[model samples]
Target chain A: MVNVLIDGLKERISNAIKINQSIGIILPASNYPDLVQALFERINSTPEEAWVYVTVTKPCDNILSQFEFLKDSKNIKFVDCISRAAGINKANDNCIFVESPTMLEKIGLEIINIFKEVDENVKKYLVIDSLTNLIIYNDPDIVTEFFYHIINRTRTKNIHTISLAIEEEELDKYLTRLIYLNDKILKVRDSFI
Target chain B: MPITELSKNELCDTGIEELDVMLGGGIPTGSTVLVVGSSGSGKTTLCMQYLINGAKKGERGVFFTITEPLFKLTKNMEGFEFYDKKLIESGMVNLIDLRIISERLGLDTEKYTVEDASALLDILRDIADELNVKRLVIDSITALCYRLQTPEMIRDFIFKLGSSLAAMKCTTLLTSEVPPRKFQYSQYGIEEFISDGIMFLGDIERKGDLIRTFQLVKMRGAAHSRTKSAMSISTKNGVELAPLLKSRE
Candidate 1:
């Protein structure tokens, strides 16, 4: 098994997780799919840790398809808020399907419920796939408030969270606000090599 | 609480046949439907027509005016051919003036607690029960949200209101003011999520002129046409919908 923390583009992220520090990642949208794969690969390396992946932009099946190697992993669960909004009703085990991404209250409640159901002995990590899609569907202030609540809740439970957003030059005020609340903000460049 | 569930065949007429056709028959019974649009997009007129049509069919209707006064709403509806004061006089159609109550409460408009919202819902429930109201319309829930603080509070109020209405088996039409800009369908963006169905009204620029258009974004349990239909409003007919501009051309 490769040590994701040893070196390369994801080394910073792997190092932060090792230190139990929550970080926010800002990267280009073009590299989002690849980054997700690499991030999950790092999670797969730790069999003792449980993960709750909250997908806002892409459907759960689409994200799961990209990481076929981790499909049968029992440590990972998904909170899908995209498929139902797109009118797709396919179901999967260990998955919670929300009506829409704009339902922030429902999404928060589902995350809490999932955390409760997981074994207390297992270390938990919460990953919000992307904040860019959330901003498109909700008011900026509302999305920021949701992040505040989620970040606080995860901290109390000793769960580390890594939120992702696309790098935009025009600069989004809300993204800036989220970065302020995070422990650290890591920018991933286009060329890992 | 779970929202009221309705089968495919269980439908309620929206009063306008063309609009109903666009909705794939009509809105499902006991559903909370959000009518979203910017100013002057006829969101209020469509809601009025729905209530008036229901009253005409012997279905008791109630209109809760949150933004506009009841007298002003009645006066404006007088221009429509379907306007009937006798229905209101006979108690078949009731208009509850919430603006007065909202003002009298003197609560902080910017920061209201969940209890304040619950008190408001209690008043509505009492009125709904006393009149056996089957059809309900809240003119501009956007105004109501403005009186609350956080998105969580706003969503909680809606969830509670929707649950109570569902238990009463009342079909509701909630009018929302769409904010200016792209992808903004409602004031807080939570309205569309909590609603069982969404109907968006907007102006489409065509041939160097603006044309009113109606689109069904989503309906939870029913199959609806996803096309944007050309629409118009007049005193004679409250709302009239035509085929899509592309198909008509």
Candidate 2:
């Protein structure tokens, strides 16, 4: 079963690279640690540089500590959306909260545009830790629209995206439909062991 | 029997067979059930089964996880039969991680502002609309409670969450972790009262091995098993249930 999922994912990733530079969405519904590791393995296997987005719903361990786990890998870059925005907005570093509608739209668009600039062969991967929380404080319609712009730009740049979401929220449909509209879709369920 | 125009109270199905049998049929379609239990209980697993079963029946499900990262949760649940990666990508079964929401919102003590529960609820509804979600679950309500500074504030939030979910006609489940031996009513008592139904999961020590159990403590307008039933976990089913106790008549 694991092989099947991996094969399907490899096929999707390879096909997207071969065909039009397309948008891809991966929905992995596993425990938090396993999901992050699975994504890390996938990113590590890719030959090109990829942008990984991590969105947090609640405060976990420090982001810096989590980032350290990936420090050995040089192909990736970390942009602390929470901290960067805080810096840009001239807010304190301790400020942790959801993005305002205006801020979400702005950052969502910015991330898409960043993916657009990378070389086609770079295999740029955009990871959004979740769409559920992004849309939680805002209107889902607006969030959908926000993703639409990102999706449109990503297709133009030939970048792929993998979005991680918790399966218990019942918000998978929204994220999955976005993936369905793209060239490839990868869904990761829980582990047997 | 192709039927339409089901009332809010008419559309619920607890999604648990035993509980449904206890009730006349199942939870009324479109009713929200609050599954409260301590950590490690089957709250998340139970909710996952509810959504998975709904997906199998062609009723779309959305999973919103606030407690853990999406990838880790998926990896942990990989053993479950319902953990279909395809279903997730195809939008038939969806998972939404709230951690990202918190990050984007930017947690600032200096700029601390009360969260808008209605706004948060709208985001969920938006996702529900896009995915055509008929069933939904928020793994735990602990995150929601922590965000608020006052009990009254949580009460207000619970009230709004209930009304918003009810308006969608989406049968929903919200889980909350409670410590053992605590009151059935939690610090946020409003969630227990406002929610249409409440279920409890607990652990008991017996002969050195920890025994897990689940019971339907309260189901508004429905009847559920009163006896404590043992629960188990396996790689294939993230969570499995076996009757440890039967009605002793």
On TM-score, the candidate that comes out on top is 1
Model 1 CA deviation exceeding 4 Å by range: A1-193, B1-9, B103-111, B247-249
Q: Can you tell me the DockQ of model 2?
A: 0.01
RMSD of each: 20.0, 21.5
Candidate 1's displacement at residue B33, Å, is 0.1
- Residue-wise lDDT of candidate 1 within B1-249, one digit each (tens)? 254545544778887987777665678888899998988889989998999898998999999987887778889999998888888899888888786665567755445688888888887888888889889999888988888878899889878877887777788999999764345778777777668988889865432235577888888767667887767675656786755424121
Cα-based TM-score, every candidate: 0.52, 0.50
Give the C-alpha lDDT of model 2: 0.60
Ten-residue region with minimum lDDT total, candidate 1 chain B: B240-249
For model 1, what is the error of residue B6's alpha carbon versus the real structure, in angstroms, after optimal superposition?
7.9
- What does candidate 2's lDDT look like per residue over A1-193, in tens digits? 6655555555554565456444444544444555555555666566457664545343322543564555455455433344432333433222223233224433543464345456667667666666656555344555566566666766666556555445545666675665555555545545323
Model 1's CAPRI class is incorrect
CAPRI quality level assigned to candidate 2 from its DockQ score: incorrect
TM-score of 2: 0.50
